[model samples]
Target chain A: MEDNQIKNNSNESQKASANYDVVIIGGGPAGSTAAIYAARSGLKTLVVDKGLTSGALGITSKIVNYPGIVEEISGAQLVEKMREQAKLFGAEYISDKVIGVDLQSETKSIFGNGGVYNSRFVIISTGSMGRGVRIQGEDRLLGHGVSYCATCDAAFYRNKDVVVAGNTDEAIEEALFLTKYANQVYFLSQTERLAAPQELVETLKNHPKVILYAGTKLKEIIGENRVEAVLAVQSDQHEVLLSVSGAFVYLQGGRPVTDFIQGQLEVSQSGCLIVDSSFQTSIPGVYAIGDVLCTHVKQVVVSAAEGAIAAMAIEKEINGRSRMMVDWSEKKQ
Target chain B: MNSVIHVNDDQFEEVVLKAELPVLVDFWAPWCGPCRMVAPLLDKIASEYSGKIIVAKVNTDENSQWAVNYRVQGIPTMLFISKGQVVKTQVGALSESGLKNLVNDFLAGKN
Candidate 1:
């Protein structure tokens, strides 16, 4: 009996050491939103992120489209605002990549560069990653004129000639935004027609500072240390030199980072989490929200809403667990 | 939060067996504390690896027949199934990396 008691005590200590109320992975919009809600519910919440400055929406230069923000705001500024809001609610922020998570034990643990974190609930908000521009000098020239986010670095090229590469709505909108700061903005589309919205297309067409080039593929970005020019292939197979101080590659779709959670969770071929209406996955205490889930449209507002809903469900689960403990205690007495 | 698809006996075969990717079925109950601990990890993984895998849950309390057939002796038993066969069985909670290695191996056609 004494041996059994010792074993039980060790197990209890292990459980206590591994226990946390909630640990949210990814400090982007979805994760931060979840943190705000979770912390507001009086749960001990920790948000782990990779410290990437630009999220999906952070790539946009001016977001006049997002609801509630009457005036247009830069993507970086908006994300910072969101981060501040989450912090205001007492959400602890941990800047690190979560290498792995342990869910099989009674106390869930998140393994990362910093250390292991144990939590009963976790929200994964690691947004999609920008697809790499596979070519020589691309990596080396990164931040030297070759950039992915137009919103974050567009201001740096004020009064200078710049090139925008992409055919998506966000890309077109970014090009339009660049016209304000850039002397001349070239909107290069690889497709025959611009894949952006009709309204955005009309806006770009009428904008005098913007130059639209269709079926133009970026061949190579040339510069000694900074981007000075780009070799572009025109639709007629004509090669043209585009002189620009900076080049913004605005690829639309992004790939999710799900390699870390592969076998334990059910994911779509596209790496989006499959969830029902309650945002619950195949596992009970687990829930997914935002761009990571299987959704037709990926937007900031949608992700925020999903975060709220997931937090509410987690709250219910926590309350249910507490009630069960109370009932057990009463029965024992 | 999106609603979870309740994979009962009627939809089990189609959702779990016919899935193109490997299916991870978590057998759990509401009152189980360990089951609660593992739920978020499963959800994080399901969303993180969506499309590459299919995640389903069988509530032992609600789906007693399925639980009986699987001979589940405890809550939070995870069965990793591929090609309609149980490839791996984990009885307790697992770390994210531990789960990732298992799934990656299965996806890579490695035992």
Candidate 2:
């Protein structure tokens, strides 16, 4: 009798989730923007979000250069507003981690722990979380000290020394977050220059607790049970060992989050989905956009634009399919 | 219990350990942000699994005995108790769906 009640509760939601015309897979800026456009175009749209602060933008502390916005806003706030706008325009949003996808057939299917969704057109707006620094002891001591998300694990290292490897936007933003709890933070960059935004770069350059390192390669993470120090090589051919309790590695050359769709899509050498000009992948009804594609710039505005373009293209395809001409004159004869 | 019951130090054993069904005890505090966020989710799960599981919360401030006994060092720590013994413990706040998955798995004896 108790099992029947649980089944009934789930079945109610499953029945409400009808077939969608366009299903945008990620609930980031790219996917939300796509949902806003697609839903406004009179198409049934659904956006699936991987809960647990899982979006690339959610990790971003602040974003100032998106154009039209006067003041700086946090990434999570901006994404929330975008989702709200999409919802206002009649886009359904659900929080579920997608486990697998089957886009070969006419009706593309997405499988998740929550439920399975079928759509005629599918958009893959799932962003990339750049490559990981695979130095010695990095993988073995993952939860011990090394962490990928500063928001999730920064609280564990209160008033302790930590190292943030790499100089990308994510790296610098996470380094800033670490400065809150960490007594001292070392921002290590392998290249000759830092790739973070000028505003953040300037802030880190003058911060009292932040120490910046340029033209340095992280060689190893030293520790017994937890992170103890980091071994690095400078441009002057000098080796330096910095003592730190925690290390946050943000490596260069990031790939898309396409492991679930590994056997389904035709990805490039760098793991980016190979899509045509219309953001349509090798499969006709399947589309991909944002950092997951082989695009040059990875700005939020660029991803939003790609989403708009993909939505318009999908609308056109849906309309064309309805008006598709078939010759049944021979059968009648 | 179908609804969320406040279990204090005096009533912890009777309300949770002695319950016929499996119990999930939430060790939380008022000031903790993640603990406040997970309260509603636990309530929803309690109602969904009414007869199958008993969900209860114990405020660490008012009830420190159980928290200290379980060695719960963090806020929003959830203890999955079965047969009067804790089978699993999870720390931190999870999404609604994440909690649902965990509860469903535990109910199915997959834990």
Candidate 3:
């Protein structure tokens, strides 16, 4: 027993040595499954995620089709169970929004809002919830007055009017952050109601600095060299132009979250990430799974299965083995 | 034999505006995701161009004087300056190839 204890201690130390073996982006079902398998096989694993509700599953009210569980549970609960399992198997989870990755080198670097993480393998499971298209003039004047990050550029608009666009909780949170610096914060929600908690929505409506514009769509950002104004359309087809110094857009769409890649990997014409049978992308060490793939079925079971396959494949590649060693049973007879 | 130089408001004039080589001034901040996305590309440019052009970074969070002077309202805003004048201004992140093309064009005296 003492010998076994010493061996386990040494193994833990080895896993915690210099760098991680695998870093999974997004803590959804697919990413968590990958982490669970990798960690169970004695590899260092780290999962970076925005939050439980950032993915499509996060917003799902009920999940009835997940295997083995007959009772209906919320999507977030199922994700939580997977996360718990992964953590139990020695996977580290951090709540950070991943913005970019450097996958060209041997040691891939993943940058997030909190810090930068490096690993030998990277798994792209940041499920599709990204903005598919850019608004008019948004591309041209991106750095002038049309900004995306409120924390980074809010100081640039001190005592100036700004418009925050979107309906997600992320948009509301950023708009609230901008209220501290900007004189007037006009929130334009494409939907009539904000997709956030009731308490947070009430706070936004009550904030004196915030002006709620529900059921309004942002048509164009009118600017030449810098952001001058924004033209928005209401549900009644009424046009309203608001003169602001900055336009902070936090809009989300039904697309893969690969824009931060910046043409680093191969992608399909429809913006889906291309991967081999083992879920490995064009880059040898990088892998993508889940809804990010156009050929993938939008089901939790399929994503989890893909995650398992990718983890096993990575294990084989790292160990220089011809075939993967499947873990069928864990009972020590 | 060169790396990206982090210029401050005090050293803006000597480092970026009055430099002998063409300057690619990157206005960035750490908290911004887009700024972080373009960082590696700038690092590559700084080493590849070396003495031909200078890749300078200005952290708007720390030094806002130069950012304000250039009327920068967004993170990762790049200013292509030549002969101590603003040649062009680009907002947001660009792909590796796009950035390389931009640098090449700037070196060949294209705005």
Candidate 4:
């Protein structure tokens, strides 16, 4: 009995030192569902995300179309419930932005803002980013004159003119921040009315340094090496040229946030990660799901189903056979 | 004043600006949803970096002097103060690990 206890203690220590069986790289519905399935199957799982409110689902105001829930629920509330369910199943969660990843080896390595983590299976469900203006020369001049993060890149355009495209809360906030550094800030909203909060809208509209252009569509971001001007069409269908050094876009449409693992996976033109019916990517032991995957529908229900499929597929691949077999005996031995 | 110190107008100077370690000031209000979310994160950060940093909170409703002085227009604004000077300021709610990264980056002098 003493020898058996010693063996059990050693086994527990070894298990504690082993890496997680699966590491999910997003905490949306898809990743959380995958974590639930994987952890319930007795596999160690970890879900790492940038933050609780970083994903698109996190920012969605309301979700009334999701089935089975009669009353409308906030997107954040739904995500929180999913996260709690995943935690109940014994899946560990970390709120850290993944900076780098290497999935070629037996044990995948994920380097995040917090620290390094290793897992046997890597699931890329990083979801999508805010859509960008897909105009001509927009992609060619990303860093030279275009920027997404006002906090990170706003200082570069000090005492110069800049154009902010979009009418959301983030755009208003970034435009407000730009007023601190730029000489004049132009806010071009595609729609006639801005869709931000009342307080924020009032502040930006009344600001002396801001120039509001309603019902404007971005025709092109004109420049060679740097952003020299922005060609846009006003509500009257008149083309207007705004000479600026930087143009920031914050559109509403979804664009996959797969920059961290672009070359590592087989991604479609729209930035969606391609996967087989089993949710497995081109690489072995690697899977993609949720808004990051190229699915016909990007609803929560579909993503959750895909996550379950991927988790079962991963279990079958790792355990060598299905665990669905039952043992029956007519007589006791 | 154990892990997360609640500083008012009177104790602000001594507990935050003149403290031995770097201080993180979280300016919050009770009505703010994001502030409520970030309050626990600040507590976790305080416990994690006990010796290296100090975390403090100032209720903007009760104390408007510091808020006006810093021109804080929003709730859930965190100010990183070191050597009696405000170094970095972020306005929004961050996750526990995200807040940890900010503290680590500040300690490493990267931000």
lDDT of 1 by residue, A15-105 (tens): 3334568887777677777887888777788887655353565555677766889877876567668788878878777654455565555
Clashes per model (N, Cα, C within 3 A): 30, 2, 0, 0
Q: What is the lDDT of residue A76 in candidate 2?
A: 71
lDDT for A171 in candidate 3 is 79
Top candidate by lDDT: 3
What are the per-model DockQ values? 0.02, 0.03, 0.48, 0.02
Q: Provide the TM-score of the second chain in candidate 1.
A: 0.88
Q: Which regions of candidate 1 fall more than 4 Å away from where they truly are?
A: A1-19, A130-253, A269-271, A321-333, B1-111
Candidate no. 4 TM-score: 0.50
Error of 2 at B104 (Å): 6.1
Give the clashing pairs for model 3: none
Give the interface-residue alpha carbon RMSD of model 4. Answer: 16.8
Residues A203-283, model 3: lDDT tens digits? 899999999999999999998778999999999999999999899998878888886676899887866688989999999
List model 4 lDDT by residue over A171-262, tens digit each: 88778877877888999998897766567789999999899999998779988767889999998999999999888876656677765562
Best by TM-score: 3
